[model samples]
Target: MILTVTLNAALDITYRVDALRPQTTHRVAGVAERPGGKGVNVARVLHALGEPVLATGLAGGATGARIRRLLAGGGVREAFVPIGGESRRTLVVAAGDDEPTGFWEPGPRVTADEWDAFLGRYRELLADAGVAVLSGSLPPGVPRDAYAVLVGLAADAGVATILDADGDPAYLGVRAGPDVVKPNARELSALHGIILGRSVTVGTVDGAVDAAAAIRALGARSVVASLGPDGLLAAAGERVYRAVPAEHVAGNPTGAGDAAVAGLARGARTGQPWPERLRDAVALSAAAVAAPVAGELSLEEYERQRAAVTVTELR
Candidate 1:
């Protein structure tokens, strides 16, 4: 089973309107809510793909209850550690022809006791997990090296790990030698700067690959960097491959990275080749862009795009 950890899980709410204007009140056209946070999003995508997944994380209060309820309703197995603080909610305002505007609430501060409880739960879940995905932001009061700790534990349990995070957590996690590290081009660039004190130009596949390789050298077993519409660049072992889509699909791009992480985690669990993993990840990411929300993917688009993905080796 694939195990996913969301340190800061959330109830993702999307509101659709005709148009968003400065300080103007309008009737909402539609509203949708789902269990979210990076790892939760990955678990949702994996479940949708018919994969056996168990999502575990920190959650509490009414919003956390709602998140777990929605997960159960969606048929995704969840095992969250209850806490004293309430979970957060993320709001997305989608206006016609305009980019979605997001308002993210700060995560609740976790107590030391609550964090220890989560660690205990995580250790137990790793026994049945073939792969563990540690993702998202570290909530207030949680250790900054949270992902690093998870990655190390997964390694000790003989389960491969895929880490998706940014900033200090990501820097520390990379040192834990996860099986895969999934970051977008911009995040990769920033991380590259953080780790090596060097600037990496974003939007160029070569630059992304170079930055990813630098990260891999720092203890990550492999690096799979997403290049938005351009696709994915994977640096694994002594090989590097580029996976590109035949065409771009337009829709909400909120969960594209998480979808890619789902594909990578699935592939790693199955021991697929790096090229094939990148192909599946790119296709899944494009399909996510064709969906209206963060957790859903268009199956038709997935099938079509999967076949059309081009995977080429890069020097």
Candidate 2:
């Protein structure tokens, strides 16, 4: 089974308006909500793919309850440890064809006892897990190196791990030697102290690969730098590969990275080659872009895009 850990899970809410004006109110045209946060989003994609997956995390209060309620019917088994603090809610407002504006709330603070409880449960789940996915930000009061701890535990349990995170958690987690680390261009730039953005150019792709190499030197067995529409750049050992989509896709790009993570984790668990894994990840990411919401992807698009993806060895 694939085990996904979302320490900072949330209820993702999207609101649609005719147009968003700074100082004015507009009537809501539509609303959509889903269980979210990086790992949870990954789990959703895996479950949709008919994979045996388990989502484990810390959740509490009304928001947490709702997140679990949504997950229960989503055909994904969840084992969330109850906490005293409320979870978080992420709001995104879509206005016409313009880019969506998002508001992310800091998740509730987790107590020390709650953290310990989660660790215990995590250890048990790792026993049955083939690949353990540690993703998202650390909630307030949780250790900054929380991902590292989880990675170490997974390693001890003989389970491969894929880490998706940013900032110190990511930096520290790399040193613990996860099987693979998937970071978007922005997150990779943050770790390497370089500037990377959504509009990834050829030069930026080179920069991202360089950053991935540096990150790999820190102990990650492999580093996959997600370059948005530019696709993925992966560096493992002395080999480097690039995977690019045949065409640029535009839609809600919110959970594209999570979909990519699902593909990567699935590949790791199934022992696919690096090039194949990158191709799968890139195709899944594009499929996610065609979907209206995060965690949902057009399978037809995924199938068509998979064949269209070009994977080449860089070195």
Candidate 3:
């Protein structure tokens, strides 16, 4: 079984309108809600792919309850610990032709007791999991080293771990020696103090490849950089593979990285070669962008993209 941990899970709310204007009241044309946060999103894709997955995290309040209900209705296994603080809700608005704008909550504070509860639960969950993923941010009151500690626990349980985090949590977690670390171009650039929304091209990709190497040297067993529409670059052991889609996809790219992480986890679980693993990751990411919402991927596009993905060994 695969285990996923969402330390800062949320109720992801999306609103679609003809146009969004400031100081104006607009009726939303459509509204969709789902269980969100990196790990939760990854678990959704994993479950959709017929993988046995258990998603665990911290949740509370009515919103948290709604999240649990949504997960249950979706048939995703969840074992989130209840918290004293209410969980967060993230809002994304898409106005016709324009880019989506997102409003995120800082999330409710989690006390020490709540953190301990999750750690104990995580330890118990590891026994049944062959792969464990720790993703997303640290909620208030939870230490930045939370992922690091979880990675260590998974190591002792003989479970391969994947870490998807940002900032200090990511920096610290990378040092704990997870089997894989998935970070996008921006996240990778942040480590080198060179983050700005740059174009995803061959030249820029080479820079990301270099950054990935630095991450691997920090104790990460492998590094996979999600390069948006350019596809993915993965390095494990002494092998590197770059997987690129045949064409660029445009749509909601919110959960693309999580989809890729799911694919990576699936490939690792089966011990597929690096090239096949990257091919799967890139195809799933493309399908995610074609979907109207996050978490769901278009199987039709996925099939095509899977065959369309071109894998090049760079090592």
Off by over 4 Å in 3: 193-203
- Residue lDDT tens for model 1, 167-253: 889999999898899888778988898887766566677778778888988889999888888888888888888899998777778
Number of the top-ranking candidate, with TM-score as the measure: 1
Full-model lDDT for every candidate: 0.91, 0.90, 0.88
Q: What value of lDDT does candidate 2 attain over all alpha carbons? A: 0.90
Sort by TM-score, best first.
Answer: 1, 3, 2
lDDT by residue for model 2 (1-315), tens: 999999999999999999999998788999998999899999999998888999999998999999999998888899999999999999999888888898999899999999999999999999899999999999998998898999999999999999999988888898899999998877887777522223333356677777887777788999988888889999986789999999999887888999999999999999998889889999999999988666699888899999999998888
Number of clashing pairs per prediction, in order: 0, 0, 0
Top candidate when judged by lDDT against the true structure = 1
Q: Across residues 172-277, which tens digit of lDDT does each residue of candidate 3 receive? A: 8888889999988777776444222343333476677777887888879999988898889888888888899999898878899999999999987888888988
User: Candidate 2: which stretches are off by over 4 Å?
Assistant: 22-26, 194-203
Regions of candidate 1 where Cα sits further than 4 Å from its true position: none
